[model samples]
Target: MYKFKILIEGYARTGANGVYFASPTSSLIYDEKVKVLVDPGTNADALRSSFEREEMEFKDIDIVFLTHYHPDHFLNIRLFPNVDLYDGTTRWHGDQEHFYEGRLPGTDIELVPTPGHTMEQTSLVIETVEYGIVFVCQDVFWWEDGKQKSDNVNDLLNNPDPFMASWKDLQNSRKIVLDRADWIVPGHGKMFRNPRRN
Candidate 1:
């Protein structure tokens, strides 16, 4: 049997691109004693408040997973000094894919490479006894009631890129996730289940 939990800080609005500024939003998935902090948003204060509300502390965290290098997803990386950092391998900073193959203590956590929202954007899939599969996707997929939409294309277009080429990459990544994920906890939206419908 497996278990999971999602701790959302707060919502950070972004451009139509759906970046969500990593404001105060983030989540944690613990396999019993091993905990993984996924995408720490920009609000260290809010994060602390959330912990206090739950009577939890940062020291309880074991690792921090960064989906990409965007400001909203990483500005607070400095907050967790004790947590080991795991990020996408293709990022301008470092390649994290090299470490994706290992298994964690008493749990099964998989980091899938779903780039295109940014070159380094990756997502997490935690297999649980109850939830089946829960994905904490950074910026790879956005939802308008479970249906995949173009929120990201609009945002990414604002940057320098072969628009068509990037769009293709984004589409491919979306398909990859669609094939496996059942429950999705997006970085900046309400939690979702049965993610293909209203």
Candidate 2:
């Protein structure tokens, strides 16, 4: 079985027109085989503190899973310069690149292509004995309050605050994730039970 821990619970504040800054939630997933860090958010200090508290070093992490190409979500990847990065579609390790379609090689984790916040946005899914099915979905679902209304994707797409790449894609992505996730670690908040699931 796999296990996960939230390294950083992220947050954001929105200002005027189209102006918002956020730090994506960072998560750690591990089993007997591998240790993966998801979305190493912009909170470098918090990340360092978490590592120190856990008595961990940079090398302990094997892969940095970037849910999307956004900077806020991936900024702290610099902390793990030597680790491999799975950027939704390709895994980058030093001078080598390995491309994967669905499941990442050598792991039970499933990579779902959940676009819209950005075109290449993706969510990492894994089933664990403790958490059941977990989806570390970045940006696809972001809210100021962790329990933002999700019963209607149309309402989400209609919200003027968020910048979306495609309404249709985000709508579908939200539905797909909500349908399957027992719990979700969203882009800029703590993990919560999937409202649609409960």
Candidate 3:
């Protein structure tokens, strides 16, 4: 069994031609001693405030998880240099899936290569005791008005070419995780409780 302490901060927006934002948050799994600092996006002030509210120092982070390299999901990685970082290898060379075991003890946290949103994209998941299972899906899925949207987008969702493969991989990754996950943590919205709530 595993236990996790999760906190949702706010949106980390990227100032590009098209505005991009990420749900910058942090998760700490007590059993594994793993602290995942999700995409800090571009809002340094929000990030700092969130960390303080959670009683966590930026220096205490152990891993930085980048759902994708779209700036909104990264940009803040530079905040931590001492911590070991993990992102889909596809972000660097636009190929290959990086997998490992026991990246965190007592926790089955894996860097799933969920491309599509971006080639260098990845998602984080944890098998927990209380929550059963939770995933830091980032932006592979979007939730609005408590509805789920599929892998479809317009200019509102314009993506780069290198991430095409990652998008396809994202679908496949979703299938596997949906079957096992009980909590769906989106990168820019509220958390989806497994079995859902009325």
Give the top-scoring candidate (lDDT): 2
* TM agreement with the true structure for every prediction: 0.72, 0.88, 0.67
Each prediction's total of clashing residue pairs, residues at least 3 apart in sequence or on different chains, is 8, 0, 6
Residue 13 of model 3 has an lDDT of 43
In model 1, where do residues sit more than 4 Å from their true spots? 14-24, 89-107, 143-165, 196-198
Candidate maximizing TM-score: 2
Model 3 backbone overlap count: 6
Tens-place lDDT digits, model 1, residues 1-198: 346665663354445777534352488777566777777878877777777876878888776777777677778778876566766442222333333333433346666777666655677787877777777775665433334333333332232223122666666776676567666666555555644422
Q: Candidate 1 — which pairs collide?
A: 17-155, 21-72, 22-41, 22-42, 22-72, 23-42, 89-95, 89-96
Count steric clashes of candidate 1. Answer: 8
Expressed as tens digits, the lDDT of each residue in 1-198 for candidate 3 is 556655553344456786654544444554546566666666677677778987879887766666666665567767876665566442222244455533432245766655665555566677777776787766665543324443333311332233345555666656655665677676555565644321
- Model 1 local distance difference test score: 0.61
